[model samples]
Target: MRIERKERADATILHADLDSFYASVEQRDNPALRGLPVIVGGGVVLAASYEAKAFGVRTPMPGREARALCPRAVVVRPRFEAYVEASNAVFDIFRDTSPIVEGISVDEAFLDVGGLARISGSPVEIATRLRARVAAEVGLPITVGIARTKFLAKVASAVGKPDGLLEVVAGTELDFLHPLPVRRLWGVGAITEAKLADAGISTVGDLSRFGEHGLCSLLGGGVGRHLYALSMARDPRRVETGRRRRSIGSQRALGRRPKSDADIEATLVAIVDRLGKRLRTAERVCRTVVLRLRFDDFGRATRSRSFLESTDRTDMIMAVARGLLDDAMPLIRDRGCTLIGLSLTNLDDHDSIQLTLPFEADHGAELDIAMDQLRDRFGRDAVTRAVLVGRHHGDDAPMLPD
Candidate 1:
């Protein structure tokens, strides 16, 4: 039986993702790590090289488990500064390739090269040049996948990983996607995958045969309908340019270092200051402050505290974040922490929301606004929190969308 692809198709969406971003950068800079099982982040495994993955090593896995899997692996601490620099260089190339770009994270993005065929050449040609440029300029391996839809493009990129390229031609999407496992679909987590397996639906072809109504009955309406559409490669989303995200966040990998309370607090302050500036610049206010932590044992925890009113002030958000961190101090001390991240969520349009009534004024907001203006006029580093001063690695690393 033949499968039908979506009509009026064009393989224009390009999903470009870095291959083992952190590990690749480490190998690119250090010759000794090349072609070896190099793992970045000794505690939580932020990234594992393709060589390490061959030995059954995966990221976010326990350091002990990774060590056991790849006994000869070269373990190193993550350099957030280097990673951010490389990411900026790579993204410069992305902008050069296409005008419409959506950054998914520090390492991955979706670029729409639908037009510009005359100037940039075919989709494959554009992707080829993009890969070559990133390799030559950033010294990193990037995988590119070109397809008609964003979902298919992303899946194509994943299938062609560790420095490779794949393009799904129009009218041939099902031929490419059907044979892949159902887990390749976005919404299929371990639990859903287990359920699908129990239902004898292992591949996209099997799921398609089971039909949308049947799948809906099995997995509930919303997720089931979504997965059914994806299983058939029918994504209608476009590459969003300059998309304003609801939340802005940043994270740092601390590796196996022993951190004092003061050290952790300093890191938290730096993160809050950076994110607060981003939130304000986006003209958004957040009601929730989320603190994400990963322990030396590779266990992760997320704690969030909501304010009574939305805020864009760094001091106010930082106070709540600090309190959340304080509450998690026992766990951090017990487990030995490895990573820290902060995200501001539950966003509101700052222009629309009247944040301050005369009775509910924030005294610190004036200082916050002044600092933001100074940083905007001069540079992001123009105003720095005093607590982060003189500390090593406290310089603001470029915050990437994630």
Candidate 2:
């Protein structure tokens, strides 16, 4: 047997971010939208293409407002499925580039390309290849930034936006960081920006000169110390792929169609079944169940419940979910539901969460594993509950990795 050991290298963190994620996908699939300002989502701007952004259009703004900014922009409904597919393909490229990848969202991640000096040329080489692969395979342009730490790498990527690459050489870290705005530092939101600007600290260089005590006095102890360090170009965090999300959720938009209680329950069942499969696949158990609803009037409501014990079992979780649904049945009846979403939170590792009941002794564990295997071998639509027979909830949306 032969064994090979991996080693770390200097300046190996690379931040890869998809440019204009949702809008990019819209343009990529529809050639007519190419080089044209595109906006995804009708009620609110979910994403704006680089072209639309150039017109001062921003995401999460009111759809009417976005259109007002750029009346020429092509508006399209959000296809979560397509976005998920693109996200998964792009993430696959990320994993292929490095074994250590910390996903920030469906669109961006921090990849550690350290210790690939022998197999891969350098951090710059790895990022270049990764970007090329994503463009070729997924048909999306991605920006990459290379630095010694995750923060700088992410900042570099943001600075080099709209399909660009930037490398912050180790020796020139401060020279590069100091010239930027204070808002570029992590945790410096609108309020922080205002505070810093009020203090005459318009740039990172100004904040860097402001001693930690003054910053602490200006921003309070916790946030003050943190920003001071980032201003000084110091970040010790590394790429961590094992840090799973607090919850895994899926939702369906049924538009203004009126659905009966039975129909709603069936839809919820489909979401629960699929999410249950996802929960178990991630080796996680949840203690809380959250139900989110959007009514025909465009109003939203969320209801949640927590259990004494954490569980990964579908039937067990479904019971709790159904209970939540029943509790909100009156609201649904009055409001006329248009969208349904469910999220399982309060997650704990399956290994760390001891079984309160003899689930395996009851033979439920065997059945769950059996169904999972069948689904894996076949498809997600392979195994379903009795209620789902001859019923359609919605198409399966693309998903982020477990």
Q: Return the TM-score for each candidate structure.
A: 0.83, 0.76
Model 2 poorest ten-residue lDDT run: 1-10
Judged by whole-model lDDT over C-alpha atoms, candidate 2 comes out at 0.85
> What's the residue-level lDDT of 374 in candidate 1?
93
lDDT of 2 by residue, 1-402 (tens): 222224343778899999999899999999999999998866557789989999999854666778899999888878777888999899988888888888888999988877788999889988889989998999999999999888999999999998999999987889999999988998998889999899999999999899899999999999999999998888766577767678888776564657899989998999998888889998999999999887767788899999888989888889999999999999999989877788898888899776465555576667889999999999877978888999975543323434
- TM-score for model 2? 0.76
List model 1 lDDT by residue over 333-382, tens digit each. 99988888888888888876664457866578789889988988997678
Report the Cα RMSD per candidate. 5.0, 5.1
The positional error of residue 136 in candidate 1, measured at the CA in angstroms, is 2.2
